[model samples]
Target: MTVITGPLAKQERDDTGALLQSTLVDLLDLSLLAKQAHWNVYGPRFRAVHLQLDEVVTTARDYADQVAERAAALGVSPDGRAGTVAENSGLPAFVSGWVDDGKVVEAIVQVFSTLITRMRARIDEAGRSDAVTQDLFLSLAAALEKQSWMFQAENRA
Candidate 1:
């Protein structure tokens, strides 16, 4: 909780920043998991799943940046180091090996689902302290839900 001389009170900013930091950690972990899937996914839809995984990685990275930037704007130092993300992120650990396209989709969907659930909780948490931070979480949650839909579709017949 650094000095934040903004419209929001110091306590409000600190609370919002904490919520954003949690989201950032999850986003960072999710980005890495997406890249892992992109590198090792194989099967009949290899090319398609591989490219889609890259899109997921890009989205996660973008969201992570947004959340981190918001925290910094409030004078809070964002902890986005790989070790911090690894240890603090709530996302489940991804299996490390070449996975079939369907399995990769399943894994991605599961991750996205978990992220969306957490984001929804963060949205409510932020709303109690800052509307702007709540809006940010809302936007991120929408994008994550869309990504989840795409991943789930790939698992369909």
Candidate 2:
């Protein structure tokens, strides 16, 4: 952790930064997954799913930026390098090559669900250390939940 003169205590900053960094890694991975789905999805709903996946990718990138910036503010070096994200991200590996619209929706829904769950836990963890960080996680979690709902809606029978 880098030296920080923030209001949070050293340990609090360290702990909170750790949680944010982890979230950043997952968000980065999820963004890539979204793009993979966007590029590969095909079927009756191909146009709709393809466009929606772009939105998901944009949101993931935005969220990742927020998490990384927050971690940096807390004095931690956010590890967002491709290698770091590849190794540390908690998200499942995305399928390569072409995929059907239904399969793409399924994969994206699963990814969003996993990320939402993890973000909720990080919100709690941040609450224990810093309310500011907790609020950040809360906002991220809300967005992820919405994305998850949207993706799930597409997959319903």
Candidate 3:
């Protein structure tokens, strides 16, 4: 089988590929979590929180595509399969059944907080080997941070 290759050294490629693959799993699972929350969220703020969930889903999906493509470009296969995401993702699962808006907002804030921390570490790791991958992580981090801030705002009095 022919393997795709990039400019980074073997070790660099391996490191960056691992980072991309991990981030891909996180993004895919996050999008699924947001969609679940979007569909089942209720309560007085339901409309606003439901709409916001869609935004998060969009952001996560967009970044997932970029991360996967980045991995492929580096000759690494990105495994975003459901089993992979379920097995590899460190993010917590959303509660089953109807969730109140307050709970959804609180849960998302926690999830984003965790993800942002990991994304920062990814940015640092990728920076050591590939600026190209690091740049993608940076943009994704910015978008996630913005969404996180929005979610945080929802929980505030």
lDDT digits (tens) for residues 1-157 of candidate 2: 3465667788998898789889989989988989988888899999989999888889889988988888878777788999998889999788889998999888888788778888888888888998988998888888888888888889955
- TM-score to true structure, per model: 0.95, 0.95, 0.97
| Model 2 TM-score on a 0 to 1 scale | 0.95
Pairs with backbone N, CA or C atoms under 3 Å apart (clashes), candidate 3: none
- Give candidate 1 regions above 4 Å deviation: 1-4
> Could you give the C-alpha RMSD of every candidate to the true structure, in order shown?
1.4, 1.3, 0.9
**Tens digit per residue, CA lDDT, model 3, 7-121:** 8898999999999999999999999999999999999999999999999999999999999999999889899999999999989888999998999999999999999999999
What TM-score would you give candidate 3 relative to the actual structure?
Answer: 0.97
Off by over 4 Å in 3: none
Worst lDDT window (10 residues) for model 3? 1-10
lDDT of each: 0.89, 0.86, 0.94
Residues 13-67 of candidate 1: C-alpha lDDT, one tens digit per residue:
8799799899999999999999998999999999999999899889999989999
Off by over 4 Å in 2: 1-4
Backbone clash numbers for all candidates listed:
0, 0, 0
Model 2 gets an lDDT of 0.86
Worst 10 residues of 1 by lDDT: 1-10
Best-matching candidate per lDDT: 3
Residue 54 displacement in candidate 3 (angstroms): 0.3
State in Å the error of residue 30, model 2: 0.8
